[model samples]
Every structure is written in C-alpha cells, then in structure tokens.
Target: MKRVDVAYVLLFDEQHEKVLMVKNKGANSSYYTLPGGAVEAGETLEEAAIREVKEETGVDIEIGGLSTVSEAFFEERGHHALFFTFTGKIVGGKIEILFPDEIEEIKWMEIDEAETYMYIPEKLNGYVKTNISIPYILRGNVIDKG
Candidate 1:
C-alpha cells in the first residue's frame, strides 16, 4: 500500500467550548471532520494544516503542538494514510465554505456533539477533552470498512 500523509488541525473557540469542523462533500457528505487535508510535497505539516483550513473553511489557524497521530488503511484503494492531528487556535478569517464543491458546510460544534459525527478515529473525543500536555500516539489498523 502506498503511504499518504495528511495533516489536521483541531481548533476550538476562545472559550474552548466548541470545535471547528467541516462537512465534506461527495461520498462522506454527512460526516463532519476537522479542517485539514493532505500534506503536499515540500510543505510542513503545520503549513498544510493552515492552508487546508483556509481553503476548506476560510479560517486561518496557528497550529500548536501535536495532538494525535493515527493511521488508516483503505482496503479498496490500497492506501495507508497517516493522520497527524494538531492542536490549533483560530488566528483570523471568518467561517465560510470557501470551496463549496469540496466542503459542504463549516460549523463550530460542541466537542461531544462533534465526536458523534467524526467516526474515523474512535478515541478522538477523549483526546480532545483531555488536557493535552503530551502527544498522544495511537497505533492500529484502522481499516476503512465503509
């Protein structure tokens, strides 16, 4: 399987009450996930996170430390994807669907509520709720059974 690198930024509001998420278009249209995308060649994870968030949600963010690292295998596509999720804060820009073709919607939802919509990483809710003093590393074969 070919390895793919992806970067995701988890951004919470000032009160840290709600998290920023985007409803993707196409196949997983109903699922809501963090504002992020694939890391292009020569771009750092932090840079990819910032660029993806701006392109998908029209929100600019400054990434903090690494939050979690996850791996998912797409059985059908023969892809091994590495997900690097980082803690981030909104630095500027407004909440809007910059690429309506790729992003269905953008919203800030409570952590608990958002977890229900984010089904990929089963332990994501706990990670986000905890005090991220140390980086969380999760290792498993997350097969894309869907």
Candidate 2:
C-alpha cells in the first residue's frame, strides 16, 4: 500500500477551556474536526501544522510539544497514513475563513462541547494530558507493538 504523512495541531485558548475546530462544507458531510492537513514536501511536521491551521482558520499559533504519533491503514484509500499531532496556542492572527469553499464553519468551542461535533474523537481524547501518545499498533485486535 502507498504511504501518506499528515500533521495536526491541538490548539486551545489561554485558559485551555476552548479548542479551535473547523466544519466541513463538502457535499456529503456534517462533521467538525481539528484544523490541520497533509504535510507538504520539504516542510517539517511543526511547519506543516502551522501552515495547515493558517490556511484553514487564518490563525497563527505557537507549537508546543509532540502530543501523539499514530499510524492507520485505510482500505478505502489504499494507503497507510502516519499522523503527527502537536499541542499549540493561538499567538496571533485573527480567526477568519480563509478558504470558504472548503470550510463550512470555524469556531472556538468549549473543550467539553467539542465532544459532540469532533469527527476524529480519538485524536482528541486525553490529548492535553500528555506530551506523547501512540495508538495501539494492532491487527485483528491484537497489540502488534510495544
């Protein structure tokens, strides 16, 4: 299978009470997820995280720590996706829909309220509590890595 690299950021307010998220405006979707996307060539994971957030939300952020690294196989996409997630804080820039065609909406929702609309819930679960996290590398529900 082919391989892909993706980087995401978990940005919260100064009080850590709210998170930045974006809603999809696609023809067949009603889910909101963190602001992030693919890592382009020659850009570091941190750089990609910063760029994706800006493109999606028009917000500049200061990346903190590497919160998680995960890998998943997608039968539909025919590829193994490697994900790098980091913690960040909004340091500058105003929140705006830079890409209206791609995003239905963007907002700062309370951390607790985000549970209802976040598309990839696993990506955010227990996220802020740790500096590093990795999902089980498993096959057939059996742990495949230590």
Candidate 3:
C-alpha cells in the first residue's frame, strides 16, 4: 500500500461567514469537502496546499497557518494517509471547477451549513474558537472509521 501526505486548503470568504467547498465527482461523488489533493513528491506542504486548490478549484491561493490535521489508515482503500488542513487566502482567479471528472460543484458555504454537508461532520462538533486541535485525530484507528 502506498503512503501519502494529503493537504487541504480551507478558504473562507472576506466576511469569514462562508467556507469554500467542493462536491466531488467520481467514486465519492456525493461527498462534500474542502478542495485539495495529494502532496506530490518533493512538494512542500504549503506548495501542495496551493497546487491542490488551484487544480481542483482553478483559484490561486496563498496558504496560511495550519488549521487542523488528522491521520488515517484506510484498510479498505489499502493506504495510510496523513492529512493537513490549512487556512488559505484567495489571491486570484474565480470559482471555477477545474476538473469536471473529479469535481462536480463549487460553492462558498455557511459554516454551519458546511458542517452539515462535510464528509466528517464530527470533526467540528466539539470544536471551540479559542482551542485548536487536529480534526478527528483522537478517533480510534479501526473503530472510528469514516
């Protein structure tokens, strides 16, 4: 099984009321999640974050501080992945779904609304504004399967 370090770019609107999201295409087409992808070989975490967002959303972004993280060993998928989620700033481009085969729709969603549609809603359930913890990191390996 291959091991991969995945990165996600979390971009909020100017008002910070909404978050950028993508309803993905392909296998998990119905799943709504943040826009980002795998961290390729030799790519820095920040570079992966920026590249993923652009490739998925066609929007150039300036990555910010690490927002959250989680690690997963997917027995079903036959791989283990470490995930990094980072805050991002929109530097250019529009909300264009770059890869139609992989991305179905793009939208800026309300925080509450986003949580409801997230692939892992519990990741934010007990989160507080002051305390920042890696999303879903405490969940067990086999039992806490997404």
* TM-score of every prediction relative to native: 0.83, 0.76, 0.79
Clashing pairs in 3: none
Error of 3 at 25 (Å): 1.1
Clashing residue pairs for model 1? none
**Candidates by TM-score, descending order:** 1, 3, 2
- Cα lDDT tens digits, model 3, 57-143, are 889987656666778898988989988877667989888877888888999887777756544457566342222333332134221
Candidate with the greatest TM-score versus the true structure: 1
lDDT of 2 by residue, 1-146 (tens): 88888887777766777878898685677568788888888876767888999999999986766656778898987989888777777888999999888988998887767645533467576545333434422233422121
Worst ten in a row by lDDT for model 3: 137-146
- Which regions of candidate 2 are displaced past 4 Å? 115-146
Can you write out model 1's per-residue Cα lDDT over 16-87, one digit (the tens) per residue? 888888988767446678889999998877678889989988877777767667888998889899988788
Deviation from native of the Cα of residue 139 in model 1, angstroms = 24
The global Cα lDDT (0 to 1) of model 1 is 0.76
Q: Estimate the TM-score for candidate 3.
A: 0.79
